[model samples]
Target: MRHLLLSTAALLAAALPVLAQEAATALPETIVTATRVPTALERVPASITIITRQQIEERGHATLAEALSAVPGLRLAPSGGPGQQASVFLRGNSSRSVLVLLDGVPLNDPSEANGAFNFGNDLLFDVERIEVLRGPASSLYGSAAVGGVVNLVTRRAASRPFAPYGELAGGTQGTVRGGLGATGTIGAFDYLASANGLRTDGFNATARRFRNTLNERDGLQAGALALRLGWTPMEGTRVEGTLRYRQNRFDLDSVPRDDPNSTGDDRRLMGQLRAETRLLDGLWTTGFRVAFTQDRRAYVNLPDARSTASTRDHYRGERLGFDWGNTLRLPGLGFATDGALNFGVTHAREEVFSLAGNTPFQTRVNAAQDSTAGHIALQYRLWNRMDVTAGLRHDAVGSFTGATTWRAGVVYHVPELGARLRASGGSGFNAPSLFQRFGTIGTAFRGNPNLRPERSLGYELGGELDLPLFGRPDFATLGATWFQSRVRDLIIFQGTSVANVDRANLQGVELTLAVRPAPWLSAELGWTITDATDARTRRPLPRRPEHVISATARLTPLPGLVIAPQLQFTGRSPEGPFASYRDDGTSFTTERRNKTGTLFNITASYVVREGITAFVEGRNLGNSRWEPVNGFQTPGRSLLVGTRFGF
Candidate 1:
């Protein structure tokens, strides 16, 4: 695998120009997450993936897990179903180290043990696009960005007349899904509104290998609504407000056993307001943004065969944040000119109230934290062939010591060869969760008041090339990157307490290819090879898959029709908490690594009318019922049919 990655990298360096135009008229792809501003794809110095609405609809991606599962350097572990708790691991870092943003609003739950974002419950019907920027980005985004950042940009109000859309689908296991929305502009005011829901009577979530007797269906019901209003009084001057609400309930399955009565509910409300304008004839721009979010969680578990205990839990968490940003631009002013300089300051307050006992008045695990940070960055292009970027940031969280981070990147273009060479290095940090810093349990377990934030240093070297294959100019594209990172001050549980204990070292390589051998045939391939280990013990990190591969092919045999087939392969991983059972089949241990697996999926769509389309989706077509985490069962084969209307 290592040799293959190197060979692929070599091949990529000899391919076509990354910015070569298909016909000299195609516009370059622009992105915002990489540099906190709109920048051309070839001009950014980061490993980033942009999934547009067109791509999402073409592939029929419905959930965050399905959309991200194919990313080269990303891994998603869904506990059981679409609504179960799903953790994201980017480039071998912990899920807590990855920051998630919904339309510029932070979505990490402050009450979660690791302050991580739940990837399972989100419905993407209102999303316009998703931007995934890989590698350390604390220099720009602060905490929870030690691994990477994901920004889900919501759909915007169209500048044209009002346009309405709807979708409805039904499938196996008594599942149903639907969405409705409209976007348009009237005079100076523009508006967007959308509502979506999904429900499924899921399959039994007990691994057959674990001897499943209780085959109760684990299911989920989820719904969300999104609305936005904007006033574009003039060019370069705009004000906007957005509101979103999501609610979900999902059944849970016990590990190493089946629990028929365990279930959970989660709800979130989020709001944001922002205004921006250009000054000095577009040479300077300024913006202010503010957001508030609330998350509520409740769970109940009756006595199961695994334990003779019944429990009830609930948590409430809130976050409020404000930001002011400015950008100055000067083209051809100096050797390192033609780009913009950006500076920003942000402040956020997070509060959490959690009770895990049988009653609402149970013992408390409540706390709050505040973080204020400022950052400045410079991005320039030297003669339109070299792209350079640098940034520095400092964050002060509550009473803890300060954290400072910095990042630098450079991309050198070889336009004649259609190739670009890129390199970037950065430092990042993840602040301790509120529960880690202030929560306590009746004298037996005390929170670590002195716990420090986890810190990491990472770097990546990469290149991209245009594929001039088969006498076709820019017929395809290939890219490769080698990355490494070191994370220190990992938090670990010591039976009764938690402490910042070890360090981790991770290294990986990613190779990607996008090819269009024919007008009607297109495909993409991604492969990753990773090595993650404990800095001190040199043992493989838990749950880090060593090899992952994803492939997708799109076939369009006729106009207004598309058929796509996708596959994902995950390698064996090292898992923990080894358990042994006696001959009586009573009280077996739990938490172990799952076997490697490959899953199959396909989607077919056809336009029935000018503004209406019908589609069918097939997931887990092979019935691979594989597990990403031991004791957590994945769904089997299922089929769904739906229609989309737009007029």
Candidate 2:
């Protein structure tokens, strides 16, 4: 691994000079979080990757998971089928360690049965771009951001008069898909809307061992409708509302014999509304947003249990918030003050019921969380052509006990030294999930209500340098960053022993590089390696892999044509077949198994006419057989051909 690091560094050094001699577009120019004030990507202190709209269209990436997989250090844990359920991992951390946001709105739900949003069900038809920040973000984001953050920014009404577009795609395994989108301005209002549907005969979660391996192979069907309406009545005051609905149904076949014939059907519907006033007076911006979401899932198990053979789970939540922020430029002390003061109240409710014939063990739970947070950031330009930024934030989590969280950080730039330095330390926490509190059957095992909220205190030290002296042709932005974070009290499942089982600690690193030699070609590579062990026993984390690497390249050889090829490699990771088991009555441990796999995906597209295009994509071009989850195998070599037309 050390050698690979050195080799990559050497490669970058060798490629930079060659790229400098060629004509290349500057790195992407817009970002919202690095400065809390939209700034160019080149100025951000952390390692960030942006998947542009062009990449989305040219690569034939139809879903969020597929789009994210080509990125290094990021891995997708797919489940069931299209729009079913999938988890994203960053730098070796699980989905529980990553934070997901849609235009700054957190999608995770402690009220849900699984404790996290089912991302597989999220359709990407409306997404404009995706930004992935690789490393500790607790200083900026808060809890569950221990690994990183994936921010999905949706599209807005274009300035164009009026436009409507749609597509139809069909493929193997009974797969069929279609979508419709429209954007325009009418009078004083601007609006955008899109609806997409996908259906497929998903592969079996487990292979031949089970009786219904094919039975385990189920069907997947889901649809989503999202609309955004904005009214800019005046320059200073504007209002916008967004409504989205996602419906999904797929069979779940990973149930133990103690409870067989188990399957799940799930549905989610969500909406948000916001109003902002710039005040145009100095640098004051005030905004208010009200959001709501509801989720329902039903599961059916063995009819021979007792008498009742089915279970039902219903979960729902809503959030209300108001915020006021100000930016004050003070040249007097070389200080610029920008801060946001936010107040929000949220309500959550959940209920799970199990029935067998005449017997039923039903449970219902509810909770409310009110929070207030404030943060101030300062930027100073020193005499040595150096720029430094310092920031601090304080958050109060609840009204009952008032749990508080805080974060602080600073970034310094030293151009003469050819180095950019940044360091941040922060504390974040996540409340216990509803399923963790009230015993339930979402997992083959039972939940423990005694579970406690997870918390952590961690810090990171990182630096980046540009190697323009190296001689590679397509070396656009050649820089690398490394970061490490320590997390304590990580949430985990426990079936026995003290506190009836709970949480642990986690640690990890990430590396990325971008090379764009000429205007006609480009390539990006990334790698992430992690080590998460039981702080006490030093044993490996259950399913987290140790290594993940990816490479992507694109070529536009013709005026209206684009072709891309990608390679994804995941290093052997250790996992136990069962969470726990006893052998020969000795209770000895079962040796962990390590798996290593690779996959290739390709796409080709051409514009046959203005606003009209045809494309074809092949996934797992290598026809590689890989396992995303234990015993559950993924698809092998699949093809999708489609076309799009617009006015």
lDDT of each: 0.86, 0.62
Model 1 stretches with alpha carbons more than 4 Å out = 1-27, 304-308, 358-363, 579-593
RMSD of 1: 2.8
Give the best candidate by TM-score: 1
Model 2, 389-456: lDDT tens digits are: 55555555543223344445455654443445555655555555555555444334455555544666
User: How high a TM-score does candidate 1 get?
Assistant: 0.95
Quote each prediction's TM-score: 0.95, 0.84
Predict model 1's lDDT versus the native.
0.86
Summed over model 1, clashes come to 3
What is the C-alpha local distance difference test score of candidate 2? 0.62
